[model samples]
Target: MTVYKQLLSLPENFSFRINLDYLKSTEDGLFRTDQESITRFIVLDGNLFFIKIYVSNNNRLVIETEDVSQSYTKQFERQIMLYIRDWFDLDIHLEPFYTIAKQDEYLKMPISKFYGLRNIGIPDIFEAFVWAILGQQINLSFASTLKDRFIKNYGKRLIHNGEDYWLFPSPRLIASLSMDELFKIGMSRRKCEYIRGIARLIANNQISREKLVQLSDINLAVKQLTAIKGIGPWTANYVLLRCVRYPNAFPINDVGLHNALKLAGSLDRKPSIDEIKQIASAWEGYESYATFFLWRLVY
Candidate 1:
């Protein structure tokens, strides 16, 4: 009785196909993807909506969701549009980054290869934090496996069209969880503690996306996140790059980034931190975009 449909216009250089490929890269079970569309449940303003996102024949982005829109306020409408913009990063214009990347030797090929690709964002800061923790120091496949197990055990689900769609576990749920529960899902002891701590911070109103974004600069933001236990520079920057909408965040020590650079430059071994800095010199204002394209090479 509450399925609502909306269409969003795309940028001139946005590629729905490339972003979809990235979303489908990991079957972490948060969303289900078919050939052309993806369906998932998202929590907005404490309301749950199962949404299907896909491209329309007219080249616009379409979102269909189940909710009682008949009596919804304007804030609800704004929230949905804003969430979609952040989720797919629709408002960002790629022309400037493309201009700079087209000249860099290491990035030139990838920029064209993955042209129109946006750094698909995790709008829920808590979900982004959990993902960064889940992926820390592990291969993507194993990290994904852990996430799949964690969500199935702890996250809520909605069944529609005879398929189940999952919602990332809420902060209140994780804050009250025991380590034993998460350990059953194969997460390390430290990761379990870190996740619970982060959840508690958010659930208790100590830290939230609004608070993080209120910081004046990227360093302050990074410092705030890194100040938390188990969140190093790499994890902090990863969160900023993916969730905080910081274009300058660079996780210099990311192993996937090192491998990508090594393969692209034909280096004898993985690039060291110094080499990564020098190689990234040309990627001043758009380090997040640079890293996303490089990650496409190996991930």
Candidate 2:
């Protein structure tokens, strides 16, 4: 195997510790991290590569690959850079968000406590969609368990140094599966159908990340995503926030969001949808960040 190394500069005020904390909370079996480095597998151009990323003393990211081939073409480099940028939300400047957050009573302390935290995102649209669907109506812990089982059952794996690195199952692979095959992994029938339905759409090229990005309008994109089976308002907004990187894509109906807000406000009851809307209005374009920080408080 050929070794490849690259260094990428991080944005000012980027907190590797906070981002690692968020990643650690996911309990995803597909990736692993230690105090020094994060390791995951990524598929590019039909090739699987294991990448290990660490923060250097100079405050830049050091990415090393376990592939032996000279695959670092211009396009490959660009893809990796974009993936890293999206994963860390390096493009978003949070100073303005901090300015607004400090003025708001509910968000002030949490924001200060979790300073430099970004909305750690899922860069793959298909992965984001399937994850959001799997999480519906279930507690996060169970959802994570389901995710682990699903990946182990369907995802491709690469073994290195006596460890396994898994790639998220592709749309083509899932689209070819039957309900029984999926159900064996503990997926409900409806969810099985939903995953297959969306997978088929993606495999057939009827929908794609490129197509959605061209839409530009968040509302229209959400509408189109919601039109697919198993994608509701919450899932659509979750995709927008995590995959599309839309700053204002807030899932107001999320139980975690409501519970976080309830705890933050010390309310006797969870706030109603109407109350959530009113309370969230203060954050405006930064609603996703506010929701993410609030989620950290409870989760």
**Consecutive 10-residue window with the lowest summed lDDT within model 1:** 68-77
Off by over 4 Å in 2: 68-70
lDDT of 1 at 174: 92
141-182, model 2: which lDDT tens digit per residue?
888888888888888877878988788888999999888999
Each prediction's TM-score versus the true structure: 0.95, 0.95
Where does candidate 2 clash, by residue pair?
1-68, 2-67, 2-68
lDDT for residue 237 in candidate 1, whole number 0-100: 96
Each model's lDDT = 0.85, 0.84
TM-score of 2: 0.95
